[model samples]
Structure formats: structure tokens, C-alpha cells
Target: MLGPGAADVAFEVNGHPASVHVPPHHTLLDALRDELGLTGAKRVCDEGTCGACTVLVDGRPTYSCMTLAVACEGRSIETVEGLAHDGQLDPVQQAFIATDAYQCGFCTPGQIMSVVALLRANKAPTAEDVHRAVAGNLCRCGAYPGIVEAALRAARARRR
Candidate 1:
């Protein structure tokens, strides 16, 4: 079932190496969801306007829906699923739950990825920084206050 221009792309995802066969036209979102079974990056907006498909590419937040799988070859891709370790939730995930940072949970993954990048660069981010970090993500449930609070809380937890 291989079509013209279909090829294999190899990349490291969530600390594991993966090679997926996809057409050159396939987006990272398509490969991650349909091929690799990494559905943490949702496909809410195929147009890339929404950050629901956000993932970390070499520690930088990227919209998977807008990025081609071939473009990610040899790069590190980290979805929300990659944030946690051996049964322990990432502080950001814990804070999101503890602070009630999400409603409906559709946009939480992208928001969390953005915050993860921000926290990596600035361990102690201000409210403004948190807001700026996730501005690309759209939350229809409108839980931004909780999101901001969670980001700050996560920062504090990281400090300890």
C-alpha cells in the first residue's frame, strides 16, 4: 500500500526511537496518531490555528499538525505522554489536576507542552510568562485562570 513519495522517517519520541512509514505529505500529527499510536497530540484543528497538536521538538514547542513527519527526522519529539516518568506524573500534570487547570481537557496537552518548554527555559516564570507561553493554544472551556495558577504551582513544585 505504499504510494509515491512514501518513505520511512526515523526519530526519537518520548525517549524511544521510532521509524514510521508515511507519505511525504503526511504531517507529524498524522504519523503520531494514525501510525505510531501516540494520540496525546489531538487533531482538533487541522489548520494549525489551534495548539491542540502541540509537541516539543528538540525542547521547543511545535504544532505537529503543521509540521511534516519528514521534517522531524533525526529530531526529538516529546508529546504529553513523554512528560511523565516511571509511574510519576510530571509536576505540570500534577499541578493541572490539583489546580483544576482544564475543562473538557481538549487543549490541555498542548498547553502543558508549551508550559514545559517555558519552565525549561525559565524555572520561575511569571504569570505574564505563563500567559505568553500558551497564547497559541485555544481552550473553549475558558479555564485560563486555572491554567495560569497551575503553571505557577508547577514552577514552585520544581523549585522544591
Candidate 2:
């Protein structure tokens, strides 16, 4: 049972119905990780500066840590876990692995999510566009070159 100030928020997650009972101030990140057991969105820099907690909300990349769970009611949330189907990774994910786009891997999920959003809109994005898309995600390992290559490769893979 939910206590005072707690409410149940129902939303679509990775095409599945998900419900979480949380207080008004509880972050979507917490609900996704704690209540829903979808931990692909990392908990780094809970303040939202780091994009490790990035998720796709209605196809737009959003920082889950900065978003309130209550605000997600009826919205669609997509995480890294949703990108794979039938044991096959999404093109973006495959590209990331092929290009070795990440190190330490803390920011990879967020970077991939951002790239996925970008690719949805522009399957033929330029390097500048890829860079712009992932600007919000910080990679301490400085893997920008590989990340950009992966984004472009993913775009190519999607086109073929």
C-alpha cells in the first residue's frame, strides 16, 4: 500500500505497461531502477549533469534522474534494455560494440539512447549531427571518435 504523499503512476515502458508507487519527489530513475527493475539507466550524477541516466520519453532523450516519476504517467519510456529483441541487439547497439565506442561503459547506455533518438529523425546524419546528438552525454574515457563512428555505422546499418 502506498503511504501518504505516495501515488501510483502508470506508464508504458519498452512497450509494456509499468506501474510504480512513489512519492511526489521520487525521480523516474529511482522508479525505473527500484520499482520496475530496469537498471539500464545508470544512477551516475543523480543531479542530471551526467547522461548516464538518459531514457527515451516519447522518442526524445530525457534525463531520468531530473524527471519526477509522477510526471511520467501515461508517457512512454524506453531504456537500453528495450533496444534488443530476440537476442539481437539494436543496430545502434551493434554498431557501438563493433566500433568499440565505449570504455568504462558508464555512459554507453545514455550515449546509445541519444544516438537512437537522433537516428530516428535522421538516418543519414553527419558527424556534426552525431556530435550534437550526444553532447549531453559525458564520456570520461574520451571515446568521442569511436562513438561518432558507431553512430554513423549504425545509420548505415539501418539504411541497408
Candidate 3:
């Protein structure tokens, strides 16, 4: 449960602790995009089918659009922008860019996050595993093949 007041939503985002005034009905996705200016996580198919609003909560991918901001009071949230470090992109991100894994880019962040989680779980996943890992994230541009190649490339890179 959230603390008292309509203006009392406080939580940590991307390692930064923050508090904001939001309506009780607002979702974590809305609060992140509209209030916190974190727009990397897309808001689409608000029912949670599209996986566009996927973000890392406690290092696990979550559908933010369906999650209440109050539920993240003490959880660590990570957006797509959080994947880079010291102005350098993470290997998965670089591989995505290199392999043209994104088309319109609307679903790229969520795809990357899902792949990130997948790679974390299986360092040497088979091609079928790659396909299954990203099946949940839908790309309107039909970049599935490129997405799989990107994940494979990142996986191979990590082994070096």
C-alpha cells in the first residue's frame, strides 16, 4: 500500500530516490513518463499485452503500465536509459543497434530488457531459446529476426 495523501508517492527510480504527487489511480508507467520524464518505457496496449511498458523492477522485467506506482515503494526500477554506463552502451544495446534489431523503435526498450533478462538467465541459449525469450515483446515493424540475431551476438560477445 502507498503512504498517505494524493501527493505522496515516493520510490526509487534508476537508483535515484524520488517522491512525486500523483493521483491514486495513476499507474507506474504514467508516473514514470509524465511525472518523472522517463519516456524510454513506451505506453501502449495499456492492458499489458504489448509489453511496451516493460521495465526492470528489482532486476526483473515487469509490465509497468499494469503496475501501480504505490507497489514500487522500495523496489529498484530500471528504464532503458539505465542500461548504459559511463556514456557507453551495454553490449546488448550495442548489438541491437548493430544488428538493426529495432525498426520504429517503439518496442526496442522492452525487447532489450527482456533479452537482458534472458541472457542473464542463459548465457548460451540456443536459437530456439532466443526466439522464445523475445516472443512476448511485439514489434510492429516485424524485426523479430534481427532481434534474435542481436541477442545471439550479445551472448557471444559476453563470452569473450
Off by over 4 Å in 1: 1-3
Q: Give the poorly placed runs of model 2, Cα more than 4 Å off.
A: 1-4
Count of clashes in candidate 2: 0
**What is the lDDT, from 0 to 100, of the residue 105 in candidate 2?**
94
Cα RMSD of predicted structure 1 = 2.0
Weakest lDDT window of 10 consecutive positions for candidate 1: 1-10
Model 1 scores what on Cα lDDT? 0.94
**lDDT values, one for every candidate:** 0.94, 0.95, 0.88
lDDT of 1 by residue, 48-126 (tens): 8999999999999999999999889899999999988999999999999999999899999999999999999999999
Better of 2 and 3 by lDDT: 2
Point to the candidate with the largest lDDT.
2
The root-mean-square deviation over C-alpha atoms between each candidate and the true structure, in angstroms, is 2.0, 1.8, 1.7
Clashing pairs in 1: none
